[model samples]
Target: MKYTVKGTQEEGVQACAKHFIGNEQETQRSNVIYPDGTEVAAISSNIDDRTLHELYLPPFADAVKAGVATVMCGYNRLNQTYTCQNSKLLNGILKEELGFLGYVVSDFYATHDGVPAIEAGLDMNMPGPWDSMTAAMTYLGGNNASLWGQNLTTSVGNGSLSEERLDDMIRRIMTPYFHLGQNEGFPSVDPSGYFITAVTAGYIQTSRGAPPARDVRGDHAKLIRRIGAEATVLLKNVNSTLPLKTPLSIGVFGNDAGLPADGMYVLGDDPPYPGVPRSGYEMGTLSVGGGSGSGRSTYVVSPLNALMARAKNFGGRVQYILDNALIAKGDFSTLYPTPEVCLVFLKTWCGEGTDRASFENDWNSTLVVERVASHCPNTVVVTHSAGVNTMPWAENENVTAILAAHYPGQESGNSIVDVLFGDINPSGRLPYTIPRREADYALPITNMTGDQSRNASAWQSDFTEGLYIDYRHFDAMNITPLYDFGYGLSYTTFEIVGTPSADLLQKELPPFPPSSQVEPGGIPGSGMKCSKSRLSSVTQDQSPAQLLCSST
Candidate 1:
């Protein structure tokens, strides 16, 4: 990929990794959310050994480790931190820690955090979305980007940037752009040449591979099935009554139930495919997958649209509401309209770059489920999200199932519906834990703060739970999550029973005792969600809720 960057530089085009440090999902990202180190330990706290090393920081680390000429900062904060201005993230981590040589780029309309960012070490702002940049510059009164301009002038005058640190920063930033010929000589155009279609098969071969269905699309389709399968997490299965066999009339519905891949958010470049919707925008202008820190796009793939297309194999059974109205406000009864082994397609959207506060913004879906559960006793809920969200209707007995597809990429829509309808069994687990309530945030106060940030050591003492991170401490400590880590459901039940076998393999998962869970009141469902409201925002402020499990 760095080679591609070098090639882009050769062509003299600005190549940007918009929104650095993985700020992909979450609406109203501008408003910060100080995730308690306790709640978002996967990405926030230094827990989960694997996540700490590979999952969360590896990509950026790899890019910089490979020398991505430039990086864009994001709008949201990470674990009570604004990613843009946190110098620890910027100078300390990216440059100093990971040895990043490139300059920092800010996302559209994300410059509001510029002052702190500059102090921390951000270098550029773009498109001037709000166009308040000029005003900001003047307001700087020579206090640019935490004195970026002033710092440079001072540093150069005093010979700081000339020093090794500044020299390194300069090389990182200028190389790629310079290679693009923006900063230097004519970038290597030989690497930037497109096959001119006629110039290729006219210039190259029959543009196909792998024999039989050798088209590139076929290979990609195969890969999507694999990745999407791994990314599909099974949320819950109560009585172990899952992995359903025998052909059953499983109702399918959702804003995304019937659609094909649009590849709108595919990282870097993924071209249009046969049967895929063509974007109204030019291919060059079509920004697929990257952080909002990259830029904005007028296109997206509707899960309903893809679900409809993918469900064609099931025939007349796959019914769509077609009303085109998002059930953002009304109940499913009002919108879903029909009722057979139902799958309600709930589509949520507040805007281009933002978030919806509650897990359920309205009683709409729950109300819909309440109404439809009687109509079709079997129902499953599937969610497509960019980040972890609060699930308001999680405990409804009528709601039989749930699956979380985190922006499952291009083929997500089709893959999700397939899993829910039994075409596939979900195996993916939550990448991060799902908190029961919005207020469960480790630090609710962080998001409200403006651009200025002072608490560098805040997370050290502030993470709420000192060491209970991710599933390790939390689950072991009896901290009940809305959904536990490693929580995934499948259609079939396979009990892991054993009598102390000596030979164990990876596939042979170790068995645990089939302990009976005795509920305190001696009643089955009384205390399950009864204590839900007990975790209100007010309560969260005064005291973090302890997981209280009692014997029946």
Candidate 2:
């Protein structure tokens, strides 16, 4: 979050730290799902003060410290009260406790009441004038009267919402503009140089006879491919089953391997209405998440075809059999049984507007793999998901290997093949822990029927686990996860050298010289960079320094 804030603002664009606190789950965003499966419009979040400060607020604190320009509050209520109207969070915690000086903005249509949110230190309500025809249908209803724009003036007139508070909000909003050189007598800067279509009026219109423009696509193609390769992690390689030997016959399964890759935040261009052609690039395979972060490119390489070509180039034969119906039924007998090696591709799509119904795998995925693993002992599973997912079948005896190719973009297939054929060594690390079971997570209860049976107004979530989230919870409970955080595998092996013993570290160390006193090649240098070729030199180096190296 800090790097994102610094990187964006350094480029002259303001970065907004979003969903202020306790938005870990996306359930009940636009509506509430009752215990009986009935749905109604609502949203809520309930977190204790300690949990809020320790687990949730740290990232935002880092963002503020990094000079984030804006903070957008989420739509959910905090502790039974809507976030936009929660003074303790926006004013007491974010402003006073964290020392945030930036403006506070509300999520779209998130402001349920204007006066309370203003009093709570919310500086802006988005998509306004607050009097738009579309916003009126939702805000002007009897269920919510406080959100109407007139309420702000009425509250100020009644002395319920002070004018001083309103003025402070204005100051917060205008401060950024003032720093951006938007003051009086300052000439407004034109943005014609920034946008592609602005400089060339007919640039976007191919029919207007303007030749196709050059882009960075051709130049950065290798970088994108390398990124995909670097991000593909080899989670399990028991018995060294990967980088298949030549003179082999391979069988590939799963629709994901053949599907065109997609996973963009937003489409390059989207028509306001149907039947209108999108002006931007064509989306070949839609892999992106829905809602806010969704965009598609013109083309993507199929992992299946890429593997087939690679295998053929290596003098090996390949066969692809896609069985959606049988896989759903937990039967793998329909697939060819003669191949020496079998590879399966698994995918889970998630983005905006909805959450996965459960952390457990759907029947079509892990369950099918379990069945296939039993049938084909040489099978290797490659998983593609937007985030961490349950992996019960990970320990199956028949499964030779498991590769986590997390939502690799357009070149996903090429990257997978690069790692699989030993062209590129896998070096990616797991960002979060994967639990063996769904119940192992901090928030076990979700959109299940009986979970939210009580009232229609909100659902209560107690952070009874406190600061024990993810690996911390696992460590505290002494429970083994499917894969611990920072756990990963590689084709090659490595070992550290010249490391002090645990007993030596337990003893107090002598006073060390400051970095300023040490020369670049001094005995007690700040750090050392080691290479695979320097393995034999490990015992010879006795310098008090930390060594860094990447094994791939």
Candidate 3:
């Protein structure tokens, strides 16, 4: 928390820790169809106090402690209350208990009632062009202004809100800018004069008049390639099939061979400006997913292209096949007799506003893998996704290896080929647990189809697996995961022969510094009651393999 907040602040950018609370699932934020034929306000996460303190709220609390500049409330509900208007969340927990001096902002179009939102402690509403459907309730007088403008007047006139409170809101929002010298008299309006004056006053002095501009592309590319290679988690490998030898005849199958560049939306079929051809758009691979927060790159080097380039130098050849047609027809063969080795590229799309349709690799992709493995004993599967996907083909005898290259930015292709050809070692670890079945997740996620079928005001989600999020639930329930947290494989193996010990302290860690602790009960004078903290901690011994990986 300290690193994320302070580090970004030091970089001259205010780090806003976002989607403040209870924003785990993005299934339906606007409206939803319940089983019965009615539409509703969408599903909400109902988190008990124990769950909130132990699992959901700690990171946010830490962010506040670290002096994050801003906090953006999510587009969901905390318990039955909409988070943007939940006074307990905004005023009570965040401002009071956490001592968050930073202002609170609403998610895009997340603000509903203006007066209530302000009273609840929201300092700003973001990204104009409000939702047309809610315009009536959210519009103030002027052409694109939010309802807050008019609501504040009405509220103050009616004594529902005080002028002092409004001033407090303005003060909170302006405080950080003032501290950063960004207030009314700052010379953003005249930066040239400001720079000249600073230089004249010796505040902007430098040893050299100007520095030489270095070509950093090669350096940046090298760093990106290294990051990508280290992030390529080898999930499975059998019979020493990886780190392919030279003189390799590789048959590459699947459209994923050309992995897209980063910054693509996590939803949607194509880029927004679709009328223009791919050639006219920024030069790069297609997006991995779609939605807000997606990225776009100027250029992308696909795995197929990278591998082909690498193969040229090694006296090796790569046979390319677009498995789209084959998969559609359920003809999962390579057509050509499988070469000495087959590399299958697979990808699944998932992101904001939708859940994955299936968890099993046992689907069509599995069929393609099964067939390819059957023909060529050496078949390696490379999967790129926005999240962890279950691999039912893990036990497939013919499948030689599996690599999880989850969203490997622009240099992914180069990274994958390097690992395959032994140019770089594979050492990435899994970031999350992959349960064998969708049901195995800590909490049950509502399916999009099911929600779409029903017309309801809102779907109520209960976080029954309180304090047992992700691997915690698996540990508590003794459920075996397909891939445990931190699980990953590497091209090389090592054995550890020593154990380091630490001295045991009889003292109980000094009750934690006050800054790191949250006092029980509600905020001092809000009259709002809150539960005592039910937070717990779990520590697991690092397996020998993990210790070795860390040392490496």
> Whose lDDT is greatest here?
3
The model with the greatest TM-score is 3
Positional deviation of 508 in candidate 1, in angstroms?
Answer: 29
What lDDT does each candidate get? 0.48, 0.65, 0.66
Each candidate's TM vs. the true structure? 0.52, 0.71, 0.74
How much does candidate 3 score in TM-score? 0.74
lDDT per residue (tens digit) for residues 1-552 in model 1: 455555554456655554555463442345333655322211222233234344456557756655467878876565556666767778886778787666887765455543445567777655343433443443334223433445455766775454555565566667766555564454344321232221221333343531232122445655675567556777866554333332224455433444323333322211111222221211211112332222222233345545455545555334444222333333455434354456655433222433344455222445554444545566666655545667767787767766666555455555665664456656566656777766554433224233333233332212344324454444535656797644655554433333312333345433642233322332122111111111111233323233222111
lDDT of 2 by residue, 1-552 (tens): 888998877766678998986766676664444567875544556777767885788889989999888899887777877777789999999999998888999876677667767888788887543433354443334233336467677888999988898788778887776665446465444433223332222223333443443343775557767777777778888788986676367877765667542333233322222331221112222244334554344456767778778877777777765554465565545445457878887766555545666664333676668766766788888877767878788888888899888766777778888878777777687867899888787565445355344347635556666667777677657878999766777676544444322223323433531111211332221222222211111234232122111222
**lDDT score for residue 429 of model 1:** 60
The global Cα lDDT (0 to 1) of model 3 is 0.66
Ranking by TM-score: 3, 2, 1
- Per-residue lDDT of 424-517 in model 3, one digit per residue for the tens? 7776777688887777874657544554436454377777766666666677678899897777866555433333223325445335221222
Candidate 2 displacement at residue 155 in angstroms: 7.7
Better of 1 and 3 by TM-score: 3
lDDT of 3 at 534: 21
